[model samples]
Target: MTARTPARTPRRTLRLPSWLPVDGYVLALLGTVGLAALLPASGAAAHVAEGAATGAVAFLFFLYGARLSTREALDGLRHWRLHLTVLGSTFLLFPLLGLAARGLVPTVLTPQLYSGFLFLCLVPSTIQSSIAFTSIARGNVPAAICAGSFSSLAGIVLTPLLAALLLGNSAGGLSADALLRIVLQLLVPFLAGQFLRRWVGGFLARHKKVLGYVDRGSILLVVYTAFSQGMVAGIRHLVTPARLGLLLAVEAVLLAAMLTLTWYGSRRLGFDRADRIAIQFAGSKKSLAAGLPMASVLFGPQASLAVLPLMLFHQMQLMVCAVLAKRRAHDGADTAETGGAPSVGRITPMTAPR
Candidate 1:
């Protein structure tokens, strides 16, 4: 009986490969979109959702203002060159590349899709993901933090201006009414948070985890309202599977170009590995959190189509950067171990940051 006892088999849990990280928030956004597609808000319901979305967006910005530490931002200014490089990559190089892609219109991308793509380029770099990736790769965390913060702050002003200039009538022409809405909905709340940060900063710190949910929930509400409007308007018919495939291909190229440029370009500029990692992650990615609300405000009813490229690109970047960050971390580890040149192509275990 003892000899007949069978050995227990270990259970194998199915998991996605490290190179392909699926973000749960992206899943939530897609689910929200599905809900909008199925049960779109219309008439009175639409009006209420729109109002709630607007108020949510304002409160989101207020939280942004409250959470950002002023002293840290001021100290980050000390690393001005690195910050400038990130800004130039985000605002200048990205826009130029987007402009060049206009040559593909009518051939590779529809006008509406192109507008979305260009808008994606004009949006700012991410803060949390940049910091998270930089930390994962053992890079200059403070610089990543500062660069992302500056890019986000700059984006609050620059994105609307850039949209008005680049997107023209497609972005509602940024009329006085649009500008006032931007100020009232985004800028004012942010400034209010900054003003009250001294009083509420501690509270935000304590409730950081809870407020994070609030942030994502607010964005999801904005998305639902935008998509519901789009559905009601029958804008879903505009995108075919063929167009989506082509758009994804174009976005892949765009992402590859940015990643390459940020990495090697920083190296040529004489940055060390850590700073280079910070620059690559910070400079190559766009912020979904910031871009979504801006799209809702700027594009109005057309926001659903306008944000499609950004939403797709956000997920794409997360997956690619997860693999890249792992490789980077492995290289960092090798450099430390060998006391010589860093290795490449080897992946280390890394949990993707949300």
Candidate 2:
């Protein structure tokens, strides 16, 4: 009895505060940006990095094609209206808002920054975070998954066409060369992956965790290469602290507007609580992962600045949506307790998408 177990010390692990829920991947992105600023590739190394980034972009799309299940996507098409609403919000409403913001240029935002801002609006909605948030909020998670996949597939073609039409020469124009690059770098690889998926899919599933890292690593390499080119081109001076603050403020307004529209607007359109949640999360956010590679291809050396607005927006959406998801879950629980219509779907643990 005297030799009883010694008082146990509770192990303490480091964690970010709930109020500041930053994703670890985002931190790695910031670090890669810093690395580019400090020691940018040049001369032969620049060419090498550029080549590697091009290859990485192709590989990334290949992975995207392999991971997406054709049958699931077709199955999701049965929820046609919800998917259409999300697409409208993503491609139509978001771009309209972005164009409306053009009035702020040369005052709140430089021409270059404005181009980037518009491009941010044109990119597809995220898949992983959209599903995660929808699940957390007790939304129609399957709808979210299909909506996101459709948007991404549509974006591969639409984004480039829109950029050529809107951004014009800033995005290397809509010439045959540009079209060929889009097909070769993005579409062809994706098709190849889809074709080979029967054989490679099993391997990919077995090493999903490892391949996820590879996916992220490829994007990081692309960022480093793009930022390195920007550094070499001496474009850093364009982004002053004051300009950055202004950009952040403009982006805050943009995010708030989308969130509000996607929620209330969906309700008015007859979507239920669960469908509305999926629409809001899927429609309101852009994919940094998809946008980055596309920017690198479209904007060339100016890719650095082109991706800046998107990068900031990505982090902003993550933080804001995380809080919103938790609140939504709480509201759903309260509704069930009061004998009201509970959320449509069961809440599931968040899983990383292939």
Candidate 3:
């Protein structure tokens, strides 16, 4: 009765990294935009840079094709509901928002920038970040894979079509040449990558890091080119800091609104929590990859100005979504503690259309 050991103290700690929240990426993207504004590249060097960036974009997609496994792609196909949710958000929801925001022309945003805004709505959902945030939130990783793939695949066709139909005049009146350009320069190469995947897929997956460099480097070139054009054309004057801030605020509201609708709407539509999370993350993002090249091709000398809105929104979505994904994780800690997990995380790459 006399010998009683002192009770041990329990460690108290919070996992800071686990709580990074999707909004963090929004800030990061904003910072990136600010940096781009500060230095906005210029001159003939910019053209060379732009050429290099275009090459990079094709290569990046090729690597995307290589990294995806056929088996995983089939597995992802099994989760059709999740995929549709993302598609609905990308194609349906985003376009609606773009239409609603049209009243902002010449006040908060210019018509050309508004065209860029509309284009961002039509572009595909992001692949890497969508899968990544879904994984972090302990959501449906396979669903994320399929949903993201579906979005990208559909965007290749749908974006151009929807633009022609809804945003035809806005998108420079969609000439036969422009339609041909989408089919030839964009879709054709992507499909080619998918067909050749069997041969180089293994090599790509093994060397993803190296290829990622190729990807980032290419985007950098596009960035320089787009900015240089803007600098040459005096497009910056149209997008003052105040207007830029207003655009971000508008985009943030747009992002939050879409995320909320997709998440809760999916639940109401009878999707499970895991599927809802995947849908929300996958559906809400805009593909910077798709947007940049399409802008370059569609808007001509004004492509940079046309792409500026999207460039801003891309970073905004990433940062805001990053923070949101993490928050959802913490909020769902109780569910995790209850020992329920639909599946462990796994992200499969999507095939690029050649």
Candidate 4:
């Protein structure tokens, strides 16, 4: 018998499919969680990291306030209907759905995961991703900028108040002390940056790229501290593979509903295609940047688990919206090709601050 040739092993490569979207920031967050799992800070080191995380959170809001132009905010006021629609989808509709999702508990989700899911609903809409996606789809970029800014500003106050009313004891009891901490830590820094914008705006503008790194790094630090606390507290076991699968299924449904509502609802509300694009993007997504620090404050040692759903949803939205934006751009090209009026507006770079 002829000797059989030795079988060759298949080459393995580290690769993601072209259709699968993954943000670098999301990878950083996953790395931070891994670090927290392996090398969680404890004892005095934990305290120091916590303190630094607090400062990082404060600095993050400061950058937010500084980067968002007051003049742009005022200018966008003329588009009140679009802004109102986005806001309603964010605060009113989202919470109502979260309240409705209480039915999923015990069977579909653990009580703890449900609480995290609910908290995710109460968070503000994302600024950078919404702007980026809208711009990419040839949507109303200016309106997206203002709507995202407004949502963040409102969320600093509304999110905590809503969590108190909606989430109750799950959100660290939501006492006056909690609200006061939220205001002092988050609101005050944001307001300070807004107040100092005239003097520092030019500097921020000049170093936008550097400050972008700062923004992401601060968020990672916050994640590390919170997850470290959770690891130390042994709360990470609240999430199991089965429960995580259920949570993801639930979140997928929620995202699909919101996307449909934002798109169809905006069209029915008589918004043009450009404005609809902005509304769909701005209204459908939650802000992980805003949510993480707030979760750290609101959930305390339980924050790592609390923020997990938000983190997952954040990545899901980015991937889904990226695909949608590309499809939208292609549709606009098709319309132009057919000699029909181009439904979408001018093409711009996909870059936008998150």
**TM-scores across all candidates?**
0.94, 0.95, 0.81, 0.92
lDDT of 1 by residue, 176-289 (tens): 988899999989999999999999999999998998899999999999999999999997788999999999999999999999999999999999888999999999999999
Score residue 81 of candidate 2 by CA lDDT: 96
Q: Show where candidate 1 strays beyond 4 Å.
A: 1-12, 341-350
The candidate, 3 or 4, that scores higher on TM-score is 4
Task: Give candidate 2 regions above 4 Å deviation.
Answer: 1-14, 343-354
Clashing residue pairs for model 4: 128-353, 128-354
- Count residue pairs with overlapping backbones in model 2: 0
Counting clashing residue pairs in each candidate, in order, gives 0, 0, 20, 2
In candidate 1, where is summed lDDT lowest over 10 consecutive residues? Answer: 341-350
Hey, what RMSD does candidate 1 come out at? Answer: 2.8
Q: What C-alpha root-mean-square deviation, in Å, does candidate 4 show against the real structure?
A: 5.3
lDDT by residue (tens digit), candidate 3, 50-160: 667666656655555555565676777777767777788899999999999998877888787787788888888887778788877778777887788778778778887
Candidate 2 — worst ten consecutive residues by lDDT sum?
Answer: 345-354
Off by over 4 Å in 3: 1-50, 68-71, 336-354
lDDT for model 2 comes to 0.91
Best by TM-score: 2
Instruction: Please estimate how well model 1 matches the true structure, expressed as its whole-model Cα lDDT.
Output: 0.91
Candidate 4 lDDT (Cα, whole model)? 0.88
**By TM-score: ranked, best first:** 2, 1, 4, 3
